[model samples]
Target: MIRKLYVIITTSAALGNALSLTNQTKFKRSPVGGIVTVRAGYAQTPFPEWLTEFTGLTEWPGIDPPYIPMDFIDFSKVPDYKSYPQGVCGVNPRESCSFDCDKCVEPDDVYTCSKLSQTFDDGPSPATEKLLESLDHPTTFFNLGINIVNFPDTYKKILDAGHLVGTHTWSHPFMPSLTNEQIVAQLEWSIWAMNATGNHYPKWFRPPYGAIDNRVRAISRMFGLQAVLWDHDTMDWQLIAEDSNLRTEEQVYHDVQLWKRGKRGLILEHDGSEKTVNVGINVSKLIGDDQLTVAQCVGGIDYIHQYAQK
Candidate 1:
């Protein structure tokens, strides 16, 4: 899961202490309204690949503060699956699509709504670039991973294109298994890399494999990052099913079922692998037919907050 990006504003520790310390990004009144000042840490560099692979044990920041919304935008206001569980597409017979599970059905097939929602993860890859180009409709939210260096130039293109860039660690490691120091290095290095290349701090983080424990949550707060997880999972990660040569139709069937069961707000996916990318691209097409937009289609996480508020 790649976290979203934001500007980091640093202030001295003395200044930081004067206010009722709330978070790394301190929220204060500035006469006009409330202001949040984000802190910048020293650049931590390239971590070993093994540290980030699991993503279950990723660590948080050393700073102690409650995590607050870095972006002022709210998403609760936007129309989404929460408001329309049947989704834009409503129910259809099992034979209509390949799967027989109720969860796999698109909301539009069963409901009355006009707005669409989409959110993608593990991107800035070669496939992502191709997908971006091939998109007949633009993506609503692109939660991109920063740890994978194989596609640095590809990431640069993504940033240059104005998509939301987030931290996925330097190597997509699990957050739970890593020590505090290891976690910090993974996150900080990714941040440094993103800053060096794109000049921003990530605002949101999704634990790799969507795994987050109390310690992980604590670290997220210290860094002023909201731990973001998804309501929908397509399970596009499984490239092959039971058969070696063929994709797993049964598992894909299960994904649709799960999606139907948990309809709304944040759809987890990937762009690092070819199969996932293929499914994601296909999913986007389905979304368009149902009058939904991917998260990037609507304005990314900032918009998600807004949509959620209403």
Candidate 2:
């Protein structure tokens, strides 16, 4: 292994300005989107004695070598879609909503106090990594719709990152459109592929296109997975990359406005597409700026299961 050396320069020290001088070196940029590399030089003499004598930053005992990766999305480079995801007409996600318990009934089936758990679908791609990194790794869980048979590394990365990997129907087919056995196969194959990563059993299932019926639900339940459906969908996937004219940001903002008006369960989002990531980022910032608290549903799945029992 090549040993690495690090030098720190405090912001207020005599030699503080000198540290910026060393950043002159430039490196290659990633051929793929939103990633860059940098070059660095280290001397065996320990960062020139003159620099260390004046700047405590150079002498800090606890200073360690940089290990953080330099991969990130430049959202600016990501142009607005020529087309945008189809906006929902008539219905707003916010407002009163009803919860269905397969068995018992609650006195008040609909309420506005509930919180929504947001989960990204159809990902494990570079876009997924970028979005997750942007969020600062909040406790928000992901229902990764991984087609692991193709991208094994992505499947491994999703599990390694501690996100929930779920079935997206192996080939991204609609669940309701398939026969019962096919649905079971889709669920089973996803689990099998996911398990190969490290014996992780998925506890969630997101039907493609949010198409789930009783049979789909039953198949999911049989696999010990809860059927996940999005309560708020901005239709980010509908955007066309080549269009020069399209959905307005106001329309996206309106979707969020709708979300704020309703009771929550799952906020449907897509992780595989840039348009989706962009919208998610916008909503996150809006929620933060407005001082709205996004609920951390630590026991989201449990709550759903328990609610079902009641």
| Top candidate, metric TM-score | 2
TM-score of each: 0.51, 0.53
lDDT at residue 165 of model 2 (Cα atoms): 55
lDDT of 2 by residue, 196-243 (tens): 443456565666655443444544665666654444555454332233
Local distance difference test, candidate 1: 0.42
| Location of the lowest summed lDDT over 10 successive residues in candidate 1 | 27-36
State the TM-score for model 2. Answer: 0.53
Query: Clash number for every model?
Result: 68, 6
Model 1 ranges with Cα > 4 A deviation:
1-116, 136-149, 240-263, 289-310
